[model samples]
Target: MMRLFIGGAVLVALAGCGETRDGNKPTGEATAKAAPAGWNAMDACATVGTPAVAAAMGKAVTGTALDPVSQPDGLRAGFSMCTFTLADGAKLTVLTREAADGDAYDAAVAAARKIGEEFGSPAVDVAGIGKAAMWTARPAALQVFLDDRRYATISLFGADFMPDGSEAARSAATAIARKLAS
Candidate 1:
């Protein structure tokens, strides 16, 4: 599939980014390591470049895997994920990106909602995280809108976690978002 090829290419391009997730998330602050220039598939892992994932999930992170993200037609449009493998064999995936334009962001949100609909998803609005945000149960992800041109999503697998009702998770995620958008 074209998607696969595009993803492969993106990885190859990103592989050149010699940076690794070596920084610590300041104590009591759930901030991501800001990728110096901007967001991309390469630095997407930086979104979780904090201990927030571990703290919120109650498990230590052991490894990470990145899923390729792109806009329609396989364009690598600032979309990517950092799926952290926890000590308990769980996954905490963070897909956060700041699109180049507003239209792209709006389109991405629509696409996410459409996919979530398949599982009889009901969106629950979330406050204090972004410009406007919501959570869809079926897909089990929190869509955080940074503005008209950017957004982020956090999803934990093999762990029953939701940031909406939990103060700890919400605070951590909010801090991460703030660090990402900075």
Candidate 2:
């Protein structure tokens, strides 16, 4: 009887210690208001969620991934990423990273810019988003400098649903980038 009571008490204790912030699980769910700061993936995903993405892209969001992928970005660890599935059979990806230092930040920025321009320079510079930003049309990607300590990006595949001009995508990406400028 004593062993049963102790086991129940331990279970209750463990349940109370679940991954959460302010009594709510820190997940990529669109319903989350805020994510745990310590959990980079959940935080990044939640910060730019359904309503924000829908308003920014001016499209309906069909779903959002509640489970996020957190891993080392190669240059640095603690990188987290999330995705939003739009109604037009397209997907929007958002990622966040915590750099080990300034050099790592520079390396990531350079790599992003290079990859962004790989297909060609059918891309344009974006202003007022971060330290620097660029939008590439071929693959539908936006890379933001964010700052010396941070960076962010929003990429998409099959973005025909975007307005005729690229302004909407640029603005939407800028808004999301601003949120990621940690």
The estimated TM-scores of all candidates read 0.61, 0.64
Give a tens-digit lDDT track for model 2, residues 1-182: 32223223222222211123333433222222232343353356676767878877778999876434444433333444567888887777775544333333444445555553555644577777766777866456676655543445576655462322255666777777666554
Candidate 1 weakest lDDT stretch, 10 residues: 13-22
lDDT per residue for candidate 1 within 1-182, as digits (tens), equals 32243234323432212222334321122224343355553346765574767666666789977776544221223567677788977565676564333434444445555544544665566766656676655445566766654567666555344322344444545556656556
Clashing pairs in 2: none
lDDT of each: 0.53, 0.54
Tell me, what's the RMSD of every candidate? 11.5, 15.1
Error of 1 at 72 (Å): 12
lDDT of 1: 0.53
Please give the distance, in angstroms, between residue 148's alpha carbon in candidate 2 and its true position after superposition.
2.2
